[model samples]
Target: MFHMNRIFRHSHLTPYEADYAQWCAEQGALLREGRLSDLDRENLAEEIESLGRSDKREIESRLKVLLVHLLKLQFQAKQVKEGWRSTVVEQRRRIRKLIKESPSLRSYPMQVLAEEYEYARSDAAGETGLPARVFPENCPYDIDDILDLDFYPQAVGSAGGQSDLA
Candidate 1:
């Protein structure tokens, strides 16, 4: 029932829905020219919100990776490898960089720890061929401990509670 000419003629139709590259160029031009009225305000706002969410998701993903490696290091002591330690260190560095860049995200690591820990536990078990029960049901590492570059998890019951690096 819609007519092509009418749809094309409608001022409500924006390049944002038709050609994204063109829309971005047009948006930039609009901003440069101070033509705020011609800008795609709603889509711009949504894009900004999406960016924040993307950073949070990145944090969650990095936390999951870090926790998974830590779990493997802690529970599968016999299988500890340099690669696992490297991954843990790399993920921690990336996570720290993210938090440093966005100070608002400073508390996000702790907030997401428990949920990401559950996922890490499952992943570690699958990767190491160990029972899920081998990992503590709750995360044993505090946020500080996990973030500490020098802090590696010790086997759960080592004398003096020190990490037994295999």
Candidate 2:
């Protein structure tokens, strides 16, 4: 699970610089691995900052794209992505224990757990190749495997709660 404080802090970085740094890191790895894309171009800091102010879906889309590039680098490095599949199980178990011993996670939504394990919605729901139809309490869903998450553009301009509308 991400510490709320850390997530809050991480979200506050100068958006453009952060995005540019992420791009540089991923692109550098691809270049070293002999797979540099000519289409990739550096964006001005102002543009990236503008992206940060955009809607959540847009932000998530950009983040997901950046994550894919990072995962490619990790795959090239032969680094197994186990945090989701491994740490999530243990964390969930601990949460359960804490709940049984006292009573929590009631105040904490399950979505927080899902995000903590970096679970993509489709994978957590087992719409992908996962064996189960839903994410088990201890099971971790990989966010990297989700390639085409869709977002409804109309939802962006509305101030109403999306879940409520659904």
- Minimum summed lDDT over a 10-residue window in model 1 is located at 1-10
Per-model lDDT: 0.82, 0.35
Residue 29 alpha-carbon offset, candidate 1, angstroms: 3.5
Give the residue spans of candidate 2 off by over 4 A: 1-84, 111-166
Candidate 2 residue lDDT tens string, 49-137: 55534433333443333332222222222333444223333433444444455443233423343443344333333423334333334
- How many residue pairs clash (N, CA or C atoms closer than 3 angstroms) in each of the candidate models, in the order given? 1, 0
> Over all chains combined, what TM-score does candidate 2 have?
0.20
lDDT of 2: 0.35
Worst 10 residues of 2 by lDDT: 146-155
After aligning candidate 2 to the native by TM-score, how far in Å is the CA of 78 from where it should be?
Answer: 8.0
TM-scores for all predictions: 0.83, 0.20
lDDT for 145 (candidate 2): 28
Model 1 steric clash pairs: 154-163
Best by lDDT: 1
